[model samples]
Target: MLIGLEIKNFAIVSNLSTEWHSGMTAITGETGAGKSIAIDALSLCLGERAEASAVRPGTDKAEVSAQFDLSNLPLAHAFLEENMLNNDDNECLLRRVVCKNGRSKSYINGSPVTAAQLKELGQYLISIHGQHAHQHLLKAEHQLQLLDAYAGHHNLVNAVSQRYKQFADLQKEFKQLEQQQQQQAAQKQLLEYQVAELDEFALQADEFEQIEAEHYKLSNSQTILQVCQRELQHLYENDEQNACSILQHSAQQFTELAQYDESLASVATLLSEAAVQVEEASREVRNYTEQADLDPQRLTEVENRLSGAMDLARKHHIKPQELVGFHQTIAQELESISNNSSRLEQLEGEIEHALEDYQNASEQLSASRHQYANTLNGLISESMANLSMENGVFEIALTAQNDRAPNSLGFDNVSFLVSTNPGQPLQPLAKVASGGELSRISLAIQVIIAQKVTTPTLIFDEVDVGISGPTAAAVGKLLRQLGKSTQVICVTHLPQVASSAHQQFFVAKEIADGETFTHMLALNKDGRVNEIARLLGGDNISKTAKANAKELIKAHG
Candidate 1:
């Protein structure tokens, strides 16, 4: 139940804060006096899309806050708990702020949340039936949705939709695969030849770099051997003027001088180390000269291998190192195409199974719709009789579209049929009902559906648009009856409806210093009489109007 609403700089509402109570509350005001401003503000808190124009003429933003008592709303409590938006007390505060730049933000319990989250939670909190709700009753789709909502088998309806989607997706995949079968077969043959060619070469990872180094060495074997032999002769093999012999002679002289000067000892040590290093270098060179030998046959084989790899890389339009990765790609494609026929067969079986599942769920939903349609027909028909059309008959016509393909909403085409007079034949509601008759029927249906809903609050924004007099009284009675169990706030112009509410609020527009503002005040007993009198006779109230207003209150009370 909504307990409070605060609006700041929202449209013509500069600042307004008010508390609400359970049971029916009537919002009444003269035309163009901003009667629905509070409703509009509450809608913002309930996650309605915002517009910059909603802001006051000079303000930068508009803000609205709504508080609801959650003690009786376990669904709402569970929602807040699941989202971590719960508070210490059993209450929920929803806030919305809209800026002048057409941007907006939402909050739950002072925690920032997405507008979508607010909408999701709004389902369990309140349900709003706008003034134009009766207009949508003319649409076929809306009729079907209303029937389904009234049926209250959302899980079964969802199951049918899900199964239909699965069936449709499989059918689409099967069609695409069937169309590509011939093209894929042709590509498969070419891929088989290319994969076979790569299979014969069978290049290993990193083998290209190793083989290239080996090929370079074999091609320059003689030069490497000659260089090693010359280095060996200069460093160790030559007896005179050799590097090792010269360094040894220098070390002996330095050693003799070191006996006289200590600094010369260090120089002798360095000379000895250099002689030893030169001897080791000469040994390495001799070893290389012994091992290095040209094998033209192996060289030719390596060169042929390198050339073949390069050629294959060129044919595939890739680098030699990429041959391995490219080979795997083509092989996988070939394998996939080879299995296309088998996959197509598998998809066919799956599509058949999905169709069966869809049909089963759809049949179940159809049966549920039929079962509940009778209940709705009886209830709405009874409701309409009380709404001034005593002879009016309401029925839900369910026709099976067996010839049509399966769809998400199942296989039934639903129509709301009505007969307004005693002798009239049942006809489509849109074709048979007058505007006033439609409004009454719409109200009846809304009342019926609201009874089945678990939402704690229901707001009717001028849903009593077309009817008046006794019929209007009936509409108010229905709303007030609903208010007995759920909170109802109705924006209405009829005094009959206003008097029917447990409480009444009067909205008035005031202009001061060239600025307009909307104000709402809760009406007391005498205030309600004056307001209802104003509704009865307009701005100029008469004694008779006040007397009639009092009588209305007394009768409804």
Candidate 2:
């Protein structure tokens, strides 16, 4: 519940701070006395849109701050905890400032917040019903929602919503599959030819590596043979000086010296090892030289094979190494195409099952709503009678349209129909109800739903607009009763309604020092009597009006 509101430099409200109470509180003033300015200021704090124009004529900015007692609201606590904005004290502060340069800033609990965040928080904190709210009731969709809310069918609604989403998702998948099937059909022949061409080569994973090694050998075969022959001659085949011959001569000399000294025996063993290594190197070189092929026909064969592999790689937009995996993918696609009819049949069956589930859920929801609609119509009609519409007929008309598919709300469209008089044809509430009647009807609905609402605060703006005398008194009594469970704030002009407030605020405009501003004060008993008397007698308050005001207050108490 809103505990306090502070508005600065906003329109005619230069600066104002008002404390709100826990029951019905009324803001009353003469026309053009800036009651709307007060409302606008409250709205700003409630995250309503604001602009520089709202700032007072010479002010640089307009600021609005509201304090809410959130000790009992778990949702508020959760939000605070989630945002890490929880305070030691259990109060929530919302503030907004609009600069003259068209910039705005918002804060929650002294922490900077976006307007959207503030708006989200505001939805849970307060609900303001101005004239525009009546228009919301006129929409058929909103009426359906309200009916559902009243019926407490949230779980059923959620189930239907989930099923609808599942159905939509399946339909999307089916459409995508159908498109894929069409595209695959168009490319079937080309894909088959490509696969066959690639398959004809019978390429293996290691074939590319093997071919590369062969290409290296065939490309430099002559150079390799020459290098190998030179190495062999130098190492072992030279007539005079060769590595193996020298090492053998050294080994004999060292063996002869080993008889004279032990160190000479070690040198002889090293020379023998060198001779063996040189002989091995020469044999390897000779074998390589004999095996190297410089034949142009062999080179041409290697080059053509390598070129074919590279060309195939380029055609498939893949590297040679990736060709193996590419073939695997195409093979899978070919298999899928061969079994396309079976796969499609499987998908169709799944879709049919999903559709059946959705249809069944929708039918169940529709039945529940239809059953609840009768009870709802009777309740609303009874509420209307209590609100002084004795002959009023209330109805929930369910129209089933073929074009309207099953939705979370069910398959039928709901419209609220009402007839204010017995002989009159029932029309949509929005089409026929005047402002006063709308106010009463809205009150009736609110009263019926008040028991179900968990929100602590309910604000009613001139809900008693077209009511007076006994009807106005009845509306006042109803608001008071509602206030027993929920905190209600009402802006009203009727004396009877004003008297019903547990706490009353009198809004009056004053002109001081060439500046005009509005002020509000909590009314004392005498003050309230005078104010209500003023409401009863207009500009002049007669002795009889004062007496009557006292009597009304006494009766209300």
Candidate 3:
């Protein structure tokens, strides 16, 4: 249940803080006095969308915060724990801030959260019924939702919806795969031919680089031989002043001088090493000239191989090195297309199973709807009688649709049917009921549904509109009855409703320093009587009106 509310610069309210109580608390005021301001601020705390206009005329922002006692709300407690927002054992605080630039922020237990998260948690805390809630009855989808809510079998409804979604998603995938299969035959054939050509070549990784090296060496063989012969002559093969003989003579002369000085011995050793190195180098040159091949036929074979590789690379619009990876990619694509038929068969089996699951769940949901529809009809009919529609008949029509495709709402079209007058045939709510009758019926449904709701707080913001006199009193009594098990807060202009509450709050606006402010005062007995009298007789409270207000409060008390 809601324990406290604090509002700062929100709408016409400037820093209003109040603690709430259990049971039915009536909020009453003259029109334009902002009686619904409290409810509006509470809604912001519950994560409703906020706007800049919600702030006071000159304020930078608006802030609304609410404190809830979660002692009786196990669901809300679990939600806080699950979201890591739990603090202070049995209390939960929700806050919302709206800045002048239209930016909004939400907080739970002082931890920042998204507005969506706030809404998710709000569902477990309170159920608010607005003044225009009845207008939603005209929508078919809302009618179905009401029926489902009344059934109180959320698990079953959720199962049906999930199964339908799975079946539809599978059907969509199946269609897309079928379309792809139809378009892939030609593509598969073309890829097969191209892959066969590449397969015949059988290119190996890095083989092209080795081939290019071999081709370059073979093409320049003559020039390489000339250079090698010229170097050999200069180093060793030349008969006139060859390097080997020169080095040998120089080593002998240095050996002779080594006897005089030790440094000359080192120089003789270096000359001898040079002669040996030149001799070894000449042997290597002769070995290469002997082994180097100069065949034209082998050169033609290598040239043809290199040309073939280049032609294939150009045809594929890639470098020769890239052919290997490209070949693997096309081969994989071919394999996948070849396997599509098997995959298509697998999808068919899965889709058939999904459809069976959907049918079973929807069938069970339809059965449950029928089972609860009768009970709901009886309860609503009873409530309608109490709301001054003694002859009104209410029915929940659950029409099964066998041919329609599976849908999230199951295969039943739920409608609210009513007969407002005697001897009148039952017709759809929008087609048959007048504005007044619809209001009464809406209230009846809300009352019936509220019995099954487990939320600790239920707010009714002028849901008693278009009702008066005995009907207004009846509305008040019903709300009081609801307060027995749940906290009920109603904002109304009806004196009877105000008198019916365990606590009364009178809202009135005052002007001070050229600014208007709305105040909500929790009325004591005398204050309650005066507020009720004002409601009964407007701004001028006559003696007769005060007497009547007192009598009404006494009777209800």
Compute each candidate's TM-score over C-alphas: 0.81, 0.80, 0.83
Candidate scoring better on lDDT of 1 and 3: 1
Candidate 1, 1-557: lDDT as tens digits: 89999999999999999999999999998899999999888888888899999999988999999999997888888989999999999889999999999899999999999998998889898899999999999888899899889888999999999999999999898888877878777788889889999999998988788789999999889888888888888998997779999999999999999999989999999999999999999988888777776789999999998999999999989999999899999998888876777889999999989988988898899999999999999999999999999999999999987667989998899889999998999999888999899999999999999999878889999999989999988888999999999999999999999999999899999999999989999999999999999889988999999999999999887
Per-prediction CA RMSD (Å): 6.0, 4.8, 4.3
- How far out, in Å, is residue 97 in model 3? 2.9
- Clash totals in order: 0, 0, 0
Candidate 2 per-residue lDDT over residues 1-557, each given as its tens digit: 88999988888788788888787777777877865565678688777787879888888999999999996898888888898888888899999999998789999999998888887877777766674566688888888887777777788888878888887787777787777778888677777888898898778888888988998988887787888888888899999899999999999999998888878998889999999998998888888777766789977887887888889999989999888889889988887875766777777888778778877777777778888889878887887787788888889898765357656666778888899997999898877887877878877877666556667777777666677887788788888888877788888889888888788888888998888888878899999999999999988999999999999889867
Off by over 4 Å in 3: 175-189, 210-304, 337-342
Candidate order (lDDT) = 1, 3, 2
Give the residue spans of candidate 2 off by over 4 A. Answer: 180-189, 212-304, 310-357, 360-364, 399-403, 423-425, 430-435
Top TM-score hit: 3
Candidates 1 and 2, the one with greater lDDT: 1
Candidate 1 Cα errors over 4 Å, as ranges: 175-186, 198-314, 317-325
What lDDT tens digits, residue by residue, belong to model 3 across residues 1-557? Answer: 89899999999999898888999999998899999999999888888888889999998999999998888777887888898888977888899999998899999999999998888989988899998988998788998888888888899999998998898898888888788888998999999998999899877888788888999999999999999899999889889978998999999999999888878999999999999999999999989998998999989988988888888899989998888888899999998987888888998999989988988898899899899889989998888888899998999898888778888888898889999889999999999988877887898898778888788899999988888998888888988999988899999989888899999888889999999999988899999999999989988999999999999889876
Q: Provide the global lDDT of candidate 2 against the true structure.
A: 0.82
What's the distance in Å from true for residue 37, model 1?
A: 0.7
